[model samples]
Target chain A: MRATLMYGAGDVRVETVPDPVLRAPTDAIVRTMRACVCGSDLHPYRSMHPSATGRPVGHELVAVVEEVGPEVRTVRVGDLVVVPFAYADNTCAFCREGLQTSCPHGGFYGNHEVGGLQAELARIPFADGSLAVVPDVDPASASDALLHSLLALSDVYLTGYHAAHVGAVGPRTTVAVVGDGAVGLSAVLASRRMGAERIILMGRHTDRTDLGRRWGATDVVAERGGEGVERVLELTGGEGAHVVLEAVGHMPAYEQSFGIVRPGGVISRVGVPQYESAPVGFGSLFGKNARLAGGPAPVRAYQDGAIADVLAGAIDPGLVFDTVLSLDDAAEAYRLMDSRASLKVSLRP
Target chain B: MRATLMYGAGDVRVETVPDPVLRAPTDAIVRTMRACVCGSDLHPYRSMHPSATGRPVGHELVAVVEEVGPEVRTVRVGDLVVVPFAYADNTCAFCREGLQTSCPHGGFYGNHEVGGLQAELARIPFADGSLAVVPDVDPASASDALLHSLLALSDVYLTGYHAAHVGAVGPRTTVAVVGDGAVGLSAVLASRRMGAERIILMGRHTDRTDLGRRWGATDVVAERGGEGVERVLELTGGEGAHVVLEAVGHMPAYEQSFGIVRPGGVISRVGVPQYESAPVGFGSLFGKNARLAGGPAPVRAYQDGAIADVLAGAIDPGLVFDTVLSLDDAAEAYRLMDSRASLKVSLRP
Candidate 1:
């Protein structure tokens, strides 16, 4: 099977790898039908995260089950499914509480023991809990746009939804999105779905800004730091935004998100932190009575609602995908995504 | 009028000060019947926070209204009241949103422009919002225990309640109260009122720990930092606490509160930061999917219920008072409070 692997920073290659097979009683192997480059992947590709030596690169995928372990009762061979980025037992107390991302028995599919999905075939663990069936949609009939939604359900879209939900975004709420990447763009859409009265996207790129605007950004602040926060405050009549989505995992973005939110507001973060530690302004947060909530999105928890919304055409979350390529060109997709030329790049396997 | 003033760190004196009069349209002059030293007061007394050359020393008080400005409608002269630490309009958008502490016109009584309650009289701005009527209770019949309730309502009790409420403490939830000061002890009581099944009080002082147990604390972790968090985690069967109340305003206490909360849980912080800034672990908070909330308590928002609870014996928040001194001994009370000899020191005028 052909899979994408990263040798080092800016080093991505498509090479033949051994096909994955069910290794655990709850595991299942799937023939990858779709995959995509994720913003998180760019973290290691840019050397911001520690590089993994010769490791598979993607975690988002829509695939057809090729094999299943005896314990996997819900999924069977040839069924089209969407796999979440994290594999959970779904029976744990945390998972039952809809915090599957923090499930005690859960692990990141790509970074931990299980191999990732930027390949012709991939193995999924805890199959009953991690895999979502695509009721009537055939793997071959799924459009590139629809497939992008599947990839999004694995992490980005659900993450954006989680950001909005955790921040308590709703009607009459003013939301500020802090990043211009795919997840941030998705947040703009999610905030709209959550009924935000005003949506502000803070970013610098024209293309990303346009995408954000299309996805329900009522305003955009191209400036960074104090100036950007000031603009958001001014737009919110000096009260700052009611909610802020910190989708860029960095000090500047995090600080900006905090600054632009009003006292007693919330900042929901979905950006994967590049460092082990970052100093948050506790004094500022304490004084403002603000809240900060985030983590890996509980994609498994939000899968049903997000899929329903996607299927209903109530939102076009797939608009985030700026390019689509063959799995053989997965290396190019990674490069384009890394270079920031594309918001999201989908791949067909 | 006699008042307690801090000339500098380690310097407190009882001296004659000018009597307060209505200073704003919403202001009211209150003749204090009772006042108390607060944990926050020690911040400036110990030089942890910069001390003004000559600043009045108290914000917690039970008083009789001496005068009211033309705009003061809810309170009038001759009424007994509990003055909340914060003065707010109660009609602003923030206040209407139940965030009186962040009201646009709100100001902390002691730190801002208004004279503080250690004085015989205080000019409380936004009187209608700051003063809660004592209702059927008479000042002559109010015991020292009830004085604790009054003083607690002025700041710590309501602050603790706000912390627990914002942290989403509820039935069956496990809570950890950090900083076993009056506020932390008050939080233990508040958590119980909110129906938290397991309450862990983190304190090093035996007296405070005992008081905490009396106030419904089910467990006590005397250690700080990693050990304290570890004990809390152990008590919760390794799942960590569902709600954490950070009542001590310092980096270490803040970190301890952050470390012990479970994923998807909340940390409510009512601690007034002593420094202009303090570091927060945003990455850790985001990864754990935890939440942080709180500020100055919206005392007026919960005053009715709290007073009712106190009067009905549903809770005895006043048990935290350890010493009672005449108003003339205010200086010594401040010193005792600063030296940690008393959990709370009540000053009767």
Candidate 2:
């Protein structure tokens, strides 16, 4: 089975690997039908140290169940499914509270134990909780657009939805989405679905910002830092956004979140932060009486809703995939995404 | 008029100053009926630089309106009122959003222009919004107990209420308050009022935690640092509290907040942070999928509800005042609060 692997910065490759087999009664074997490179993948692509042995890559996938352990009751063979990046026992207290990412027994994909999602066949643990059936969709007959949208449900789309939902975006809110990546654009789509009347997309890329505008961004601010904050404030009538969806995790993006959030508003960051410490004193969130929310999104909790929205044709989340290739072109896919040549690259296994 | 002044660290004085006069259409002259030293006051007391001319020293007050400018429509002479520490127009967009502390025209007391609440007479800006009339309570004959509770409404009690409110404490929540100060005790009171069945008070001071127990603390964890975190986790059945009310603004307090918060929980800090930066990365809040909320409590927004609760005998927030003295003993009041000899000191001018 061919799978994606990374040996160092900017090094991505597809090589033959042994097929996965069910290791637990709650496990299932998934034959990947769709997979993609994520924005987070670029983080390692830019700085990971070189090594003789490569690490597995990719965590988003739409696949068909090929085999299942005896205890796996929710998903059976031949079913089309979406996999959350993290797998968890759905009945755990944390998972029951919709925080599957923190479930003690849960773990993310692309690890030595679970293997990567960008592969021909993969083993899934806690299959009942980790897999969501794609309602009314046939795996072999589904369009690439539908498959791509379902793949997004594994992480990106659900992450953006989590940011907007937790930030309390609504009809009364003016939303500011920071970043033009797939997740940021997804935030625009999610904010619109949450009924935010005013949506401001902040980014430097005209190409991505254009897509953001099409996805319900009432205004686009192609500025960074103070200027970006000013543009968002101006677009929101000088009051700033009631909800700020920060899809970029850099300190500047976090700082921009504070500067553009209205007093008593919320800033939700789905971006994996690059730094550990940031100002949270009187000069920022405290004085403004603002709230800080969002983290590793519990995508498993949002899978059903995202799938419903996607299948209903209410959103075109798949549009984020502007480039596609066979699994063998994994290196080119990484280069395209890392260099900003592609918003996201879908890989066919 | 007699006023309290601070010349430097640990230095306080009672001196005569000019009587307050109307400075704006929204201004009112408040004849001091009751005043108190606050936990925040200790900040300036500990770090202020020595100077020839001392700065005014108080903000909390329960007073009688001596005079009101033409535009002061909500308050008038002879009304007994509870004043929020900061004054705001209350008609601005921010104020309408219940964020009076962020109102552009709002300002805190103790500045040279407004004098201080610990004075014979003080000038209050935005009188209509700053003063909440103590419904049917008589200043001349009201019990000292009632006066103290109303004074708490100005800041401490309302601050705790704000923390509980923003953290979304409810019947389903297990609340942990991280401080034994007036505000933290007030949080125990507010959390109980919000219908939380189990309330944990974290502090080393037995006296204060005793008061907390009386106010509805079902459990008391006197441990600090990692031990405190472990105790709280034990109390919550190893899942941690659903809401952590952090009333101490130091880094350790903030760290404790994250340590004991359950996944998807909220940590609300009402303490004036002593530091500007803290961890919000994968190792802390982000990994836990928790939220960071709270800042300066918007007392103005909760002023009315607090007065109603206090007057209705639903709460006795004034018990935090265990010591009392005349304005001439302002210096002693500061010393007692500074040395922790007094839980809080009530001053009569």
Candidate 3:
């Protein structure tokens, strides 16, 4: 089976890889239908993070279960499913607490033991807990838009939902989404679905902000840093927003989150943090009583609800996919996403 | 009037100072009935923090209103009150949000123009907001225990309550109070009051742990660093506590907070942070979905309820006051608290 592999910085290729097989009674083999390059993938791609040599790429996928072990009771063969990036047992105390990302037995995609999502065949452990069935759907018959939306449920949409959920975005709450990438745009969609009355999308790109407006952003701020905060404050009547969703994982994005949140508000970040430390001192988040929450996101826990919303047409998070390609064009997908030439890119396996 | 002044490191003196006078329609003059040296006081006393010359030393006070300006409607002359360490206008958006410490017009003790509480008289700005009345009692007639408990409401108790509140401690929640100082012991009491079923107090001091047990600590862990985290994990059946109250202000304490909190748990810190930055990266707090909340306690917001509880004997946070002295012995009070000879010291002016 062919899969996307990263060899070094600026080196991405589609290479034939050995097919995955069921290793445990709880495992299931998924034949990928759709996969996408994630914003976090850029972190390692840009060499901001160390790359694993010849490792498969991608962690988001909507796939079909081709085979399952005897103990995999819930998931069935040929079922279209959303595969959350992290595989959890869903029976641990942490999983019971809806923190599947921190599940003691969980492992992430691209790890030594698991096949990546951008592969023709991926072996998933804890199948019942990690895969959410796209009920009654035939991958071959489903609309392209629906498939893309379900793929988002595997990672980005659920991540954005986690951001909104942890930030406590709700009716009457004002929200600010930092970053205009797919994750940020998805956050705007989630904030809207969560009943936020006012949403501000912070980014400089005209195309992204336009999509942000369509996705329920009440305002858009193009400025960066202090000016961006000022504009957000101005838009929110000088009080800042109640819930600030940080979708960009960097020090400046985190700093902006601190600056534009109202006192007693919350900043939920699902962005993969690039910085090792953040200055959250007396003058920053603490004195203001602003809470910092959300992390890698409990995608396994949120996938079901998000997929249900996507299937019901309550949200259209798939619009974030501005570019699409075949599996062979993996390098171009990386270049587009890395250069911000596309908000998101989808690959058909 | 007389006040306790910090001349330099290890130099505290009781000296004559000018009496406080009303400078605005919002001002009220408070005659200090009781004041105490705080655990945080040792920060400046030990030269861990910079000390301005002749700056008054204390922040916790149970005082009586000596005079009030025309706009001070809620407090009256001769009324006993709890003076929140920070003065807030109460009408600001932040104050309305119960984040008085972040109020636009708020100012901290010894920061600038506001006089400190360790004085005969303190000129309180935003009197209506900063002073919570100690109802139906006169300082002259109140019992010593009641006075000390009420004094705790002025800072430590309210601070502990803030930690519990922000950490979201509630019925059946397992709580961990790190740093068994007065604040940590007070947090134990607060967690119990907030309906936590199990409370763990982490500290080595027998005296403080004894007080912690009296304050409803169900378990006490004496180990430090890795061993300490292991002990806490063992006590919680390896699940960690649902809420960890961080009362020590330093990097180690913060690191310990990150160590023992359950995934999706919260670390509420009322300790004045001394570090400029913390490693809140993806691998530490963010990935686990643990939240870091609480800063300077919004005492102005919590003072009334805490004082009422103290007055009603619902809690006895005052037991932390293990030593007492007159204002003339301010240096000794600092010495006792500085050397851990006293959990807290009350000084009568």
Candidate 4:
């Protein structure tokens, strides 16, 4: 099987690799129909994160079950499914609490124990809990756009929804989305679905801002950092945003998200912050009485509803995929994404 | 009129000053029947906070309305009242949202525009919103303890209650209180009132721990910093506390409060963090899905109910006041509090 592997920073390649096989009783093997690049992937791609020698590159996927282990009961051969980015047992107390991202037995695919999905086939552990069967869509009939939404359900879409949901966005709320990447744009869509009265996208690029507008951003602040927060406050009657979605996993974006939220408002951050310890402005948080909530999206927890929204045409999350290519072109896809020329890239296996 | 004036740090004197007269249309002159030294006051008294030249030092008080401006409608002359430490206009949007402390028209009584209650008489602005009538208590029959409770309601007691309430404590929730001061002790009481099943008080002193136990702390962690968070997590089955009340205003205490709370848990911080840009580990908060809330307590918003609880003997918040002294001993009271020899000090006017 062909798999996308990274040898070092900016060194992505598609090479022949052994096909995945069941190694645990709860594991299942799946033939990947679609896979995609995630913003988090860019962290290591840019060498901002420690580079792993010969690392397999993607996590988001929509596939058909090719084989199942003895303990796998819900999924079987020929079943089409959406696999969440994180693997969970589904029976742990944390999983029961809809916090699958922090499940005691959970682990992320493409990192640690599980292998990446940018390949011909992949191994999925805790299959019963990690795989969600797609009800009616035939594998061959699924369009790149629809397949892209299915792939998004693995991480980005659900992550954006988690950011919006945890932030308590509602009809009376005004949301400021920091980061114009796929997840941030998805947050705009999620906030809209959650009935936010206004959605502001903070992005620097015209193309990303245009995509954000299509995804339900009612306003856009093209400024970055402190100036962006100031603009958001100005747009929101100087009260700041009622809810802020921080999708960029960097210090400046995190600080901007915190600064622009109003008193008693919430900053829901989905960005995977890379720092060990960043100085938090406690005085600002204390004085404003604001709240901060986020984490790895509990994608499995919202799989049903989010997929339904995608199927119902209430949202076209597929718009986040600006570039679509064959799995063999994964290296170029990584390059395009790193160059900031594409919002997201989808790969067909 | 006599006032407790601080000429500089470590120099407090009870000296004659001009009598407070109505300075605003909504102001009222109150003759303080009783006042108390607060943990916050010690900040300036110990030179932790810069002292302003010729500042009057007390904000917690139970007083008799000596005079009222012609525009004062809610409070009348000769009425006994509890004056909230903060003065706010009841009609501001922030006040309407129950965030009286952040009201656009609000100001801290002692730190800002007016002389505080350590004086024989003090001027209170926004009288309609800042003064709560003592509906059922007879001033003559009230014990020193009861008067302390009224004074506590002006700030500390209500501040503690707000912390627990904002943290969303209730049955089935495990609460961890970080701080051993009067406000933290009051939070133990407040958490109990809110029906928290397991209350853990984090402190070091045996005396304070005993008081916490009496006030409904089911468990106590005497360790400080990271060790304290570890103890809380160990006690909570390794999941961390569901709600944390951060009552101490310091970096270590704030970090411990953050570390001890579970993913999706709430940290209500009523502690006035003094530093301008205290380091906040947003990644930890983001990864855990935790929430941080609270500022100055909206005392004026909760004073009536707090007073009711005190009068009904449902709570003895005055137990926090371990020292009582004459108005002439104001300097000594400040010194005792600064030296940590007293948890709180009540001054008789």
User: After superposing the true interface residues, what Cα RMSD does each candidate give?
Assistant: 3.2, 0.7, 1.1, 2.9
Candidate 2: pairs in clash: none
Q: Fraction of true contacts kept, per model? A: 0.57, 0.85, 0.87, 0.59
Off by over 4 Å in 3: A48-53, B48-53
Residue A79, candidate 2: how far off, in angstroms? 0.7
TM-score of chain A of each: 0.95, 0.98, 0.97, 0.96
What does candidate 4's lDDT look like per residue over B307-340, in tens digits?
8888898989888999999998999998888877
Which ten contiguous residues of candidate 4 chain B have the minimum total lDDT? B274-283
Best by DockQ: 2
Give the alpha carbon lDDT tens digit for every residue of B1-349 in model 1. Answer: 9988877777888888777766778888888888988888887787734466587768899898888999988897888798888888888988888888888788776643776788788888888987889787777677767767776788878888898989888898999999989899989988888888999999999988998898789998998889888888889889889888989888788788778988888888888865444434444576778877777778888987888888888887777788899989987897788778888888887
DockQ of the two-chain complex in candidate 4: 0.56
Please rank every candidate by DockQ, starting with the best.
2, 3, 4, 1
Error of 4 at A229 (Å): 3.0
Model 2 per-residue lDDT tens digits across residues B211-263 = 99999999999899999999888888888999999998889999999999998
Each prediction's TM-score against the native?
A: 0.95, 0.98, 0.97, 0.96
Candidate lDDT scores, in order, read 0.83, 0.90, 0.88, 0.85
Q: Where does candidate 2 stray beyond 4 Å? A: none
- In model 4, the runs with Cα more than 4 Å from the true position are A48-52, A276-282, B7-9, B48-52, B276-283
Residues A99-180, candidate 2, lDDT per residue (tens digit)?
A: 8998899998887888988888889999999999986677889999899989889899889999998998889888999999
Give residue B258's lDDT in candidate 4 (0 to 100): 77
Docking class of 4: medium
Question: Between 1 and 3, whose lDDT is larger?
Answer: 3
- For candidate 1, list the clashing residue pairs, or say none: A280-B280
